[model samples]
Target: QPRHSKRQPEWHQRDQDELVVNQPESATLDESQKPAYADQDSGSNKRKTRGIQQENAKDTVVLSKEISEDSKLAADKAMEAMGANILTELKEVQTNLKKQITDQSGLITKEMSEFRKEMGKRLDDIVADLKDVKNRVEEAEQRITEVEEFNMDVKDVLSHTLQLQEDLQTRLTDLEARSRRNNIRIHGVTKGEEGDNLQKFIENFIKTELSLTDTTLGIQRCHRPLGPKPPSGSNPRSIVIHFLEYTMKELVLRSAWGKKVIQLKEKRVFFDQDFPSDILAKRKAYNPIRKILKEKGLRFQTMYPSRLRVFYQNGPVIYNSAQDVSDDMRKRNMFEAAGKPTEDASQPKPGAFSWEGASGIQRWTRETRVKHIQEKLRAFKHNDNTL
Candidate 1:
């Protein structure tokens, strides 16, 4: 058998509306048609419908595949373009970043060079300043050394000058003391009573006291030395008598030495050599020691200008100054004081016994200062006793 061929019917809207109105004709045809023929038609119609549906499906698949191919090609082109653009942008960004890095590196290198130069210049300047400071320090040290040397020379010159001045003063004082060797100060003499016959009256008194009437004693000026007169009703001014020979003065002093009081017209008087004030002060300092010697009956004599010569049993012991005498006496345990003796004599004397609450200055103890003060006070008291 041959395969059955089928045709699909096309129905318009007007043809379907006309068939609806002609339904009796369709019924009469159905009644007259054979079963086989009707089955054939129906099968043919079903086959035609299936064939149309398959064709439509094949066409739709082709169209869809074509559309998908077009869309995939367009997507591929777009992606290529986008990828090219992204690659170009990335290259540009990389180039720009590389250029910026290069520029910054160059700038940093230049800045570093400039900084190096600046730092080098600063270091050089600092080195120069340090050198200058070192030079200045050396110069200052040199100048200080020179100043110290100059000060030393000036101090040496001052010391020599002071020594010379002291020597000159000592020589002058010695000369002055020697000059007054033949002079005697007759204390407690009635002022203005000696008159023009002052030398005659003194000679008469000397002759009567010493029995030197036969001796021709040469007399110099006899008068009161220039000074403030004593207040009225006090003792008369002292008479200063100058003898031409030192022997006559010595004879007068030795003769009057044992006498407690000498009378001039029933008024008591005394004779002493006219010594310098300094020598008088020094002589007064020896009185205590002298009294000690006299009491012990030791042979001691006051030497020229206030030196003391003690005739110790061992030999002659001479003391040049009051300090020397005092030191020697202390060494020999000659006397004792109420307070303990100071151990260190080199320290400066203190102003008082209680030095607490005082400024922080090293000072001698009370015992040392009191010893000096007592020495001076006793010396002054001795002077009063002599007067």
Candidate 2:
């Protein structure tokens, strides 16, 4: 019977779902603390243990009291030990959970730092690109300004050269007529003095405009006549404009100043005010003045545009004489003057007649033309009386 009743074969361990189902709050307290309705069957286990202990007592009433005291002390000790074990388990679980939270916080901090650094690098690259663009824009603006100044200079040169051409033509005619009266040609009437004066004027203009030091511009000129054989030494001269792009470089002849080249110094400031390019653009839509300006240097001299046919194309002097001055006469004049006459196919033939439009007749507008009239009007400005 004792073998069969041995704890009923421990039903909590054998043939059971022994996994931790619930850590109930009630399980924290002792099962013995409950009263079980104060009934005999309900409290049988505790009562049986007490009665067996009492029967095993072998001393008198005083001895039995001492033994019951010892039993109560042992039960109190067991309960205290169980409470300590439960507290230790709770502390271990709490420590592990706190460690996990700290590790997660560290990982998040590291990721955030890496992301911040990456963003900073990208922003730096963007700022550098913006700086480069700004520099290019500044450079482009500077180049445009240089081109504008060069264009203005070309305009002035064209006007001045035209005036010179007219003056030379008028003087040549007077000299030729005087020589004809004598029936003997007057030689040695070269334009050396005038050519030097024109070159000096160019240098002074550049100096005045730039206010620069160590700057010098040299110009040379020669002239020729366009006609049949007039004489061996009667060809006109040309006014050549030359400059040095750099100090050590070869002299650059500025035959035709185009807008595509000419840049400002590296450190100079850009244009302080807007240029006339915008106005030119508008005018060019209906009237391409630029084309005329480029094609024709300056059709000067006569009151009508048709007279422009008598001017030089590439040379300074245009020899417009009476018809029948054959090629033999022109060659003789070219040699007497010791000048080589270059034939320009673009020039009009001798005695060729044609109807020229507004481009042929209009001199400078009335306003700009006044300067020419005034030069002749001024007394004592020149020794000659061509006016």
Candidate 3:
């Protein structure tokens, strides 16, 4: 039922004729000279028609096969050309990759060598600096040792110098005490009592007080000792007298011992051998004992340079200091504890021979002696209250 284009047998003949005409091998013929199929027999005509149809069918088949062959050849040619172009591009890419890998490897090797050299140089410099530090440390240690030795030597020198200074001070004090030996101090004397002629005033004073007109007592100089005047209402300053001979000073001092006070123009004066400041300080410690000895009518004298000498009937007892005298009094038991008289009346009196204790030896310690002196003072106070 669908309509299709109808094929014409004459069209195929015409195409074949055109092909034959264009060929040099084909014959040229007129239409009038061609055989007429209408004038032939029916059997012969049928054969001719069948033959023509078969020939036409053969020509169509040949044409279709030729066309298919040509198409297949064209497709093969195109495929080969495209494959060649792809292969060429792939080869070029491989070459470029190889060149890039070579260049990068060379650059990395060069940079590594330079880095190694720089590290080696820095390590060498560090070693040198450490050696210099070590040398400086050793030098500092040496200097410290020397300084310590110098300090020790300086300390020894200072200690020796201090000891020498103490020795010098002791000798100087002794020299000063010796210088005052030939002089006497007349205490409680009114200022200006010497009048204008100081020498004549002293000569008259000795003659009148000691009744020494028969003896020749040589006098050298007389004056008020150097010092500020006493405050108003206080005792006047003493007259210091120097003798031509030390014997004359001793004579005047001995004669004035029992006479506790001397009178000069209605003023009570006292006489003492001149002593240095240091010895006077030492003598002040003996005042308590001196008062007791005086009341007992005991004959005791302070010897040259602050020594005390007591003349007992046996002989003389010399003491270097007031502590020595107190120790002696303690052992002798001259004053009893609490000031009561000893019950043993057979114990000789204070001025007797027993005071010279077994050829004058001490048996008590310093502390015991001090305790005895305190008890004696207490006993004296108690006895005076009872009286």
The lDDT values for all models are 0.72, 0.41, 0.68
Model 2, 1-387: lDDT tens digits are 122222322433332233234323443456676455434443564575476446434323544465567667777888888889998988998998899879988988898999889989989999999899999999998998998687657545655665686687557645644332211111222344335465454355334434433545432321233323334566433222323332211222221121223222332211111112222122223222223323445343321111122234554332232121124225435323333323322223333333334457523333224334544434223332332
Taking all chains together, each candidate's TM-score versus the true structure is 0.49, 0.21, 0.41
By lDDT: ranked, best first: 1, 3, 2
Between prediction 2 and prediction 3, the one with superior TM-score is 3
Cα lDDT, model 1, residue 289 = 74
Q: What's the distance in Å from true for residue 210, model 3?
A: 1.6
**Per-residue lDDT for 1-387 in model 1, tens only?**
111122222433454466467544333565556454565665765786687667667755666666677777878999999999999999999999999999999999999999999999999999999999999999999999999788767655655665575577578778988899999888877876667788898888788877788987788888887754466998887778888999988987888877767887788889888987556766777777776566667788888777899988789998977667668767876665422223323222445432333467655454345346545545554554475
Put down candidate 3 lDDT per residue, 1-387, tens digits, no spaces.
111123344778696687556633212334454455433544564685587668877866776665567666766777777788778877787788778877877887788788878888888888888888888889988988998677556545544554554466457667876677788988887767777887898888888898898887787788887664567998887788888888888989888876767898787778887776556656766776676677666789887677899877788899987777777877877545323222222212233232224457535433234334444555554554475
Candidate 2 Cα misplacement greater than 4 A, ranges: 1-115, 177-387
What is the C-alpha local distance difference test score of candidate 1? Answer: 0.72
- By lDDT, the best candidate is 1
* Candidate number with the higher lDDT (2 or 3): 3
- Who is ahead in TM-score, 1 or 3? 1
Positional deviation of 97 in candidate 1, in angstroms? 13
